[model samples]
Target: MIPSNILNIFTNTEPSDISYKEECLTCQIMGSATCLVAGAYFMSNLPFLGSNTSVKRNPIWWKNSVKGAGAIIFALGILRGGEGWLWNQEKYLTNESK
Candidate 1:
């Protein structure tokens, strides 16, 4: 689980009248989605693009970049999942009370 401080870096919440500093959740979701999709696409097509040849070594930077991007995307997805779970719980509790 991401620490509250780190999560705060990714999302701001309004408590009473106080607005906390945080990254836009929507932007996080979009960024993660884009990175994951793009990384997957590039990785899948790399072999077919003659990048598999021993003489023409695939760039190490490219591999690392894709992996790193994918990891960020995966982390964001986990955070979003937590958010969604809390959202659903709130909705459920609200409905139950009514």
Candidate 2:
């Protein structure tokens, strides 16, 4: 499971006192969503790599492998963005409270 702090970074609602930055929000959401989807799709397929399932024998296996590799890369993006989001949100909130 993703850590709560990290998930919070990707999932927080906009702060009420803050001005909305559409570009930032859109980028964050899109990046995170894309990363999550790609990662999940790839990671899910990874378990099948070693399986004796018919999928292993299919030409699709090669495609799946490629996708799996892409997913890992995307997942890393999610991690990076998630950390940044959390940190920024924390700083914004703390400063606002002062």
Candidate 3:
């Protein structure tokens, strides 16, 4: 069985009366933060948190791979932003008409 927390992520246990604005805000915040953090790591060599902290120690292919992955992640976050906003809009309209 899937863990409760993991399952909860796939399900919305919130009450029907909850506002869509709140949900959208939560999603946007989470997505933006994730993308920003990951993109920063991929593009920099700040410290231990950065994947290229020891660029000289690692190989060229690995660095390129990390950058590619980061770009994909950032794009996904953009898609998520649109999805989250649209979901909230649809839900809000449906709820209002009910």
Candidate 4:
């Protein structure tokens, strides 16, 4: 029989009991930073139909900018909101083995 310790590695892990509050807090801060930088870039660079008369408008620019900004907002929101609910919960975990 395989050693129990080795078998444990293959088995579905029990829900993580450690809250990892510190790590979550760190991620939230980083996510906020990501949002700020991304937001600034998108706002300044992604505008369509600017004042230049020769500039041709591209629809893809707006779509991609909105999509990227929305994704960042969503990820950061999860990180920030998760700190209070996800990590603190007794049953919640990111277990992929199950």
Return the top candidate by lDDT.
3
| TM-score of structure candidate 2 | 0.38
List model 3 lDDT by residue over 2-97, tens digit each: 556766667967857544434456867788778867876775544335545566777677767788777778776766676635554776566556
Model 2: how far is 45 from its true place, Å? 2.6
Q: Model 3, which residues run further than 4 Å from truth?
A: 1-22, 47-56, 84-98
User: How would you encode candidate 1's per-residue C-alpha lDDT over 28-97 as one tens digit per residue?
Assistant: 5776576556556654555347665653475777766666666666655555545534554675455455
Indicate the worst ten consecutive residues by lDDT in candidate 2: 16-25
Q: List the residue pairs that clash in candidate 3.
A: none
Candidate 2 deviant stretches above 4 angstroms: 1-23, 46-71, 88-98
Candidate 4 Cα outliers beyond 4 Å, as residue runs: 1-10, 13-15, 18-24, 46-57, 60-98
lDDT of 1 at 91: 50
For 1-98, candidate 4 gives per-residue lDDT tens digits of: 65567677779579775644334556666776777566655545445436345434556565576767766766665556565466655433443223
Query: Which candidate model has the greater lDDT, 1 or 3?
Result: 3
Give Cα distance to truth, residue 22, candidate 2, Å.
Answer: 9.5
lDDT for residue 79 in candidate 4, whole number 0-100? 59
* Residue pairs with backbone overlap in model 4: none
Report every candidate's CA lDDT.
0.58, 0.65, 0.66, 0.58
